[model samples]
Target chain A: MPSPTSKPRGILPAALFAVVTAVVVVLGIWQPFEPGGGDLEIAGGGDPVRGEALFAESCAGCHGEGGVGGGGGPSLVDSPIDEETATRTVLAGRGTMPAGILGGTDAVDVGSYVVQISGAVEGAVPPVAEEPPLGPAGEVQLTGPRLWGIFVSLAQPAGATWTIWLDGGAQDALRVGEIPAGQTTFADPDLGIGTIIDQYNRVIIGEQLQDFALATDELSEARITALKALIIGEGNPPGANSLVSVAGEQFAVFSDHTRFLVEARDEANLANIRFHSEHLVNIALGAPIADVDQNGEPTNPGDGVGLLGQDGREGYLPQIDAAAGVGTIAPLAELVPAVEATVADARVCGDIASVEAAGPCVNAIEARSAKLDQLWGQVPDAARASAVLALERP
Target chain B: MSVNVFVADVSSGYADLMETVFTSAIVGKAWLATAAIVLALVQLLSAGRIYGKLGSARILSSRAAATVHRWSGRLAFLFTLPIVFHCVTILGFQTTDTRVAVHSVIGSVFYGAFAAKVLFVRDHRYPGWVLPVAGGTLAALLAVAWLSSSYWYFTEVRFGF
Candidate 1:
């Protein structure tokens, strides 16, 4: 080429080199897409040693010697109740149980012991099954206190009512009133904040016996409660040899909804991503009791008994945060307004207007949502299927 | 239209696509880098043959070596594009650790060297050994980049996708 002249255009190459270097520097500073799928060593909190005696005296009466059930209560051994929910339930009570029988720390310990014995926490205990406590389609089955939560959910709607025949042992009193929906009431006066539903209506939290159908589309809360009194007059879930709406019959809606939402993450517009995330967190914990999180001005009755609340398990949210590798993502309690602040930085900054510019925010959101998916794995399939029924009614 | 939306779509979509073939994007990158390294090996051998450093009888003919060198270099460059896409656009230059810092530092200048080499290919005003030296430097940079990333990925992380 022209006898290969000794003179070279140094300025052009230098300019090109400078431009490329600048591009890399800009890319480095402007964005950071973190990698997922690493070792998430989730060391659960709470000790089991403290929970032994508490489980023996307080829980053994109904749950049997080792929480095996076949007694007054369903089996807690090998069943699904997250530690947080169990701790709260032990502290507050559910169904026939009275509240404040144990210390807050011991409550966690009791739940942990139950969870360990039940093989709910997976790696914490030996592997019972290869897969997690999920159905084929990844669902959690609700039972026991969670079942009572469903029973309570039937009466939680604004107009729904239950004529509770408060069995004060010697069959003393009957509370036939408005009683309000989703209030943590001292139901039996001395029983503290405990859910007491003794017989009457179509609302059954457990399908143990099945045939629990009691259509409550228009039944007043009192009427519904009275009907429940008749069906389960003796108290405890009615025993049926077979079932119609078995382990997630109409519950396919939740699985489908969750799948759509998770898959939608790929093509998410980001505007509603945070909204859905906050919705999920609220569903896990309630503000003014069993109200659906972020649904109405005062929180609608959606899925009551958060997965992290009483009857679920403890340390669930913290475990999720640990797995995320992001450290303390959002508010743990169901504080509605503060949730929006969590995503304010990503959305408020007008300068971040492109994919590259939105890198840090995208990274954060992805890390969080992915970890939330892991939380679902802890829930049993039956609980997952049963929990969504709150959304099926008024 | 919004930055968050655009990023969410691109990053998740890309990750989901990579996950379809491999376990994750990181695994996909490891395999992709290995492929690039193989192509780079072809470039090295072919370049040696073209430079008469390698015996014609022991390797391909000079013309044949030149053809192989051109094609292998092009292919190697092509193989690195996706990796560069994920590293620069998605992960960027991370310096979380010694290995990562080295990878980031070497990776940042990789394209810069490519730009200089491209310019030198056209302009013959440089010394005779210039192109060879540039090519060697690129290979060394790529080798280190592979060591810090793909090698680390296979060794420190899981070996399988």
Candidate 2:
């Protein structure tokens, strides 16, 4: 019944197929192909229940039960305020009202609930904003308090080793005397131009209006110029600026700020260092620090005070704090110093000029890079990896 | 109403989990797609050997090669299901731009071509050129799908892990 030419069935190909199939299936299920870690869930619709609970705890005393205007707060019930306006009101606190202490998602959730109870369930859920195009780098606003924290954190035991490079000044401007954290007497603070109270009520220096400031004392003039360009602009005739220009310019500042912290051998500015470091981590992972207005542009532009719009600040503070509390910021904070040290050592190597002299610096950079890789390998989650990777390049 | 709820629940469940998995890992979707393409190449080669297109070398007997071709084709097809499910149920058939439009069109045709190949494979009564045409069309569609997506991802977004 069988032709003589028909070859007998071999078990090898079938066996190999089974083994390969098994491996592929296992790999799919285990998802071991992920280089860093699992994927991160971008923020989406808010949980109204959580929002309601947050409102009861923080809003009920002022706005009354179910947001029915009472006790000095206007009623949100059937309130004509749209979701955007409500979000702003809750975050910034209208008139005598204080800013809400809720995170961005929580704030949005609360806004949703208020809209729902007001019988405007239609359009209660706001449309998610599309990711802005990765435009050329432009000037980013870095906060004075955070920069001061980075400076103080990285300071040697004697004090922070660097001086602030101000515009229209012949030399780097050094702080004349110790200005305590809450003091407001100094004419100019270290980072920015004016003085203002941070969300913490602690008096802090204003935004750094200068083109750039030295992130670390050891940085060469070229590196300083590069870092400054990243912060403000390259002074490249208007539209030619880099991605640091219009969107997420804070990231560039944060990247260099963390790099400066690498040489920090003291605990003096550790708290400040951690605070700004956490902010950088949150922003990199698509956290909204500022609310773009209806025209899809940054509201309160050139406000010259807070990094975020007045309303955005209310929401930004708590979300960053929450991100810090959960240890999301810890690995990144630790990794920043390592990256900073490696880049600094590389710079030292580059300064040697002569190839013979440069060998040791090159070797040191290579070794430090290997160590950095090992540290990167130890990162436990994808969210951390995403944030870290952004800093890894620049 | 219940059906709509079920569909929403299922779509959200898959979309949220897969989106996280897609964006979190660096160029992961691209890499998985690359792996699928490599398997597809193997399917193409084995299919050719079965058809005697590789001259008279006869690396595999007709029976053995045919069996390998069938199984490899099945596996290659199976490899695309998750990606297809994600695209269809979550992303839907979007044509937002040129690249996406090309990808969506090829992706839709790929399933149709694949169905034809499977049907042809089961039936030996088809014309001589029919099976080859079906197989060729499926492979070509997959290549376009890969070119529009994974290739673009690697070159433009990121190449290394």
Candidate 3:
């Protein structure tokens, strides 16, 4: 029997809370959500070594070992394929090729390895076939007290040789002994100091290098002074270089995805565009290196979860969250909920803490959700949205 | 064999079997805990209705709510078996940290509280408020136990199996 004045219990709020808690638990257990495939899915640098094994497992049957064309697939060697073409072809699976034999970072890793071997196999030019980046022309060895294994993981497996260029000499393809990948030199390469700086920064933040020697024996004094600034910043946790890594990736990765979003829009592939939007939202909110809820580093995802070591690793979202999700990360906050809403509702909108901001998000989600198929026209707007996120990235 | 060794054997044996269904024992524990929480909520809601703390203007009459509460309570208890067995036998009692200490303390009392609540339900001679207090205490203890271990794992470590 019910009281005459009894009202229905507000079960909706309780149900909604239960649902959110379950999602959070899922996200916690499934840290490092997979990036749905796109041309730019695996942006920037990747470990070719890890990719090589993945390639062997996933692709060698069709593409042959070391990508030296087999009876089943064309020789990747001497192939003019750039990273973008390779990525798109591999993910979309052209001709008799199957789609998604590999995906996510593994796909990107294989792509990186494929591009490297494709050029290296037949004395070919760099993957991009561009003129060498010019800078200080000097040859120096990279050696230190630390085991080269750390750098090896960065590039070149043990006993497998890498070819860097002493393009400092008056020769093209001026090959140096096994150096790391980022110390890049295309045939007739014009090497840039930026390459060395990038590599050194990675070594500093990602891997602990005690007595890691930076061979500057042959360097000009001016170069050494610049190197000194970078060297001095090492050994400190969350160094300026670490911030640069996070901040830089936020812009670079987000910008790359924004371009992909535009392309997906042209194709009007709803899933693909939504995929990039998800990454954009990730850059704006979800993915973070640190556990935001706890003061201490989280114990899950034990792969250096809060180490802030990996230069290109995911952590900016956590950083923003740590900073209290405010005056920072301004990527089309207004328009984002419209797209994020398409990601199964106001879950993402809840991440936007500003009550005032959330008002439009809830409305936009409801209004524009039914029109997702026609969301292609909004690609240009997504690009603007990405740019908005870029301003607030790290 | 010693009790510690026997406990370890049982825990490992159960966990090894669980691996066939889950990626790891912890993962199995996670899903089980989630199921228990959902069922516990059902128990809470239905109990509220039966006690007149809530009214069933909807399809739920007092008798139906009582039935729902009983079944949900049984299922919820069943779901906690594997988790509690593994935790007690494998990990045992520990006060290594604040979270662990708090969880261990609450978990130690949960079964006792649950037993008391069950007895109180059957005994018409008991005071009116005792059963509800014991039942609420059991649920709160379970919630806190979940927050300490499984929740931490999902949030701080990994979310999916």
Predicted model with the maximum DockQ: 1
What TM-scores result for chain A when each predicted structure is judged separately against the true chain A?
Answer: 0.22, 0.20, 0.22
Those runs of model 2 whose alpha carbons end farther than 4 Å from true positions after fitting are: A1-394, B1-5, B16-32, B56-59, B159-161
Candidate 1: which stretches are off by over 4 Å? A1-6, A32-394, B1-3
- Tens-place lDDT per residue, model 3, A182-203, is 4432222223332332223222
- Quality of candidate 2 docking, DockQ: 0.05
Off by over 4 Å in 3: A1-394, B1-9
Per-model TM values vs. the true structure: 0.36, 0.32, 0.32
In DockQ, how does model 3 score against the reference complex?
Answer: 0.01
Model 3: which docking level applies?
incorrect
lDDT of 1 by residue, A1-394 (tens): 5357467766877788778977886786554332111111124746675576667655653465566553235667667766666655654345434333343344556766777777767676622323222101111112243133322233222211212222233354433222243331212222222233333222222111111111112223553333233222233444121121111211122233334334434564443333343444334443434222233333312244333333444223333333222232333323212223323332322123343444454455444443434433332232223222221211
Give residue A207's lDDT in candidate 3 (0 to 100).
8
Q: What is the DockQ of each candidate?
A: 0.12, 0.05, 0.01
lDDT of 2 by residue, A226-339 (tens): 333333234445213422233224334434434433322133343333333333233332234332112233222121222222334422212322332334534445554655
> In model 1, how large is the Cα lDDT of residue B111?
85
Chain B alone, TM-score, model 3: 0.90
lDDT of 1 at A250: 15
